[model samples]
Target: MGLVGRVREGTRPPESLLLTAPGERAYVDRWDCDVAAGIGLAHLIEAFFTSKAFRAERLALAAIGRGGTDGEALLLAMGAAQNFAAWTQVERRENEILLEDFAGRTRCWLAVTPSADFTTLSFGTAIMARHGMHAAARSENLAFRALVPFHRPYARALLMSAAHKAVRLRQRAVSGG
Candidate 1:
């Protein structure tokens, strides 16, 4: 994967709650990075939730009455939180966590797998769209189609920004700041 990850033709794991149904679709993108200070899932998650791209999205969600995060972000940064203002922890392990929004329309899976010397971080998202009674609109709805251009770029930006922030954070920590 590149700095922000790779667009791969893959499906979520069988244990994932964001499974694809008969008329639903799933998208998986992965980002892999190796940091000198060794970034873990918690650190990466904190960097993500506090990144510029994510803050903008969080603000927009808050404007729509669907988000909040001052305290939750703090908790997440300290690796002590599971439920944020916009999403709840659907599943978790020592190095991975799956989160789903309250509406259950989107699911995010983040994993940090450690190799011998480098740690790889992967991020994925699954979105489910359902259309009204229609014969051919089973794959995607109008909104989903319209959102494709914007969503793809936003996803990349979000991952990129977060990964960069994690690197910065590691550097600062290493510098004794």
Candidate 2:
């Protein structure tokens, strides 16, 4: 499989995926690191809301719809998270998801964030809120692991429970947890 395909299959993006196809595919999968990151987001979301896996997949797909990442020259690379959220709603029919020009709009949305440190945690939260959803407290646990550098052990344990709950929810959904 191609590097992009492998990345979707849970492998990290290898250097080979970054080759420029030029006249061949117009864009090479390797040139867009966000695609890998997008996969991560999808996996993360799936880990949280098993019943909502389809929505999470739709969110990930929406996030990448605009040329994988570099489709828009003006937006920051991180803004793709917003696109993912936006597309989820569009796909869910929770809102009217229309693009005047699909390619152009995707390009514009992809170019919306320019900062290297833009985390879509807030954006994803907002989308979750709109869907009347919240991260299982278990995320706070993962956040604890993620925030060990910040030294918030108590908070980490709390969030870890949420993460654990989320995992159980998925397990139950899959195997009756």
Candidate 3:
């Protein structure tokens, strides 16, 4: 089976940067992938942090912020960690988590929805990076809007890589490897 994530038509992010105070520009996007039914949040988190694409990001962030060398060890310890590199775990649930950057300009949400046959993994991002305090704002501003094209594909790649990992994990679990 192939590993790819897709966004359903007309389904907006359940929670997003769009909910903001006056003068703040908002933007949000989401991607979803199906994996083995038994997979859970910890598994997904592990796959995400260990994914090649994210590994690069981790190393880069580690250089400028918290050390990405922490790797899966850090992301897997979500229960105890309040900060990861520059992200702070703001909300934790049995199936979902929300993290925000220190500046509060960016937010990430990850979740898993398991059915009888497979689990749907979701990755969402919210950004408010472009705006003037006194400028007119409707939805997303130009700066963040401009980055959407690149950001969409990068985010999808990260999730897709993680999904591939999740599939491998499932195979291992099934085989007891």
Candidate 4:
């Protein structure tokens, strides 16, 4: 009655609902959105991809309640941790966690302290780029930008596999593919 799909409404009520206690059905109803959201992601992914890594990362993040910004952060984190920063660490200052990356050789330091979840990753990625590793720095950016929006049923699976493959393929192509 409130808003159709926004609130589950139907003409015929369940016969068992009359027998069950008020709190008993609450658990089931609570999970309804989760189950539906899960199925939606799967359906969307399958209908969208030609590969797997793209699917996996997207699904993993979605399952964890993360989206585009998180996706971007993830890419940046990977680049910074693996390529740009020779060392990365978190520091507590007042009430915040500051993520710091050091370029090691040049003694250049890049720091981004996010008050929110994915900011550290994005910050780290910027650090990596600032240090001059363009390839590693931009991989996640490319994935998030080019491949992460399929929204098909097999989305997660296809995204993971496809992302891995795409990276490899891109590497090969760049090296002379």
Model 1: per-residue Cα lDDT over 77-104, one tens digit each: 5668878877888777778777878877
Candidates 1 and 3: which is better by lDDT? 3
lDDT of each: 0.67, 0.25, 0.68, 0.27
Top TM-score prediction, candidate number: 3
Each prediction's TM-score versus the true structure: 0.75, 0.19, 0.77, 0.18
Q: For candidate 4, write residues 5-70 as lDDT tens digits.
A: 121111212322221212221111100111111112112222222234444544654575542343
Name the lDDT of candidate 2: 0.25
Candidate 2 segments exceeding 4 Å error? 1-151
TM-score of 3: 0.77
Question: Residue by residue across 1-177, what tens digits does model 2's lDDT show?
Answer: 111111111121222211211112211111011211212222223332222323343456557662222222112122233333223212211111111123222110111112353211101111011111357544643553454343323222322332333334434656753
RMSD, candidate 2, Å: 18.3
User: C-alpha displacement of 140 in model 2, angstroms?
Assistant: 24
- Tens-digit lDDT track of model 3 for 1-177: 334344331244434322322234367777888765467777677677677878878787778866444453444445655666667777777887777777777887777888887788877777855645655543446666778889988988888888787667667877999
Model 4 per-residue lDDT at 165: 36
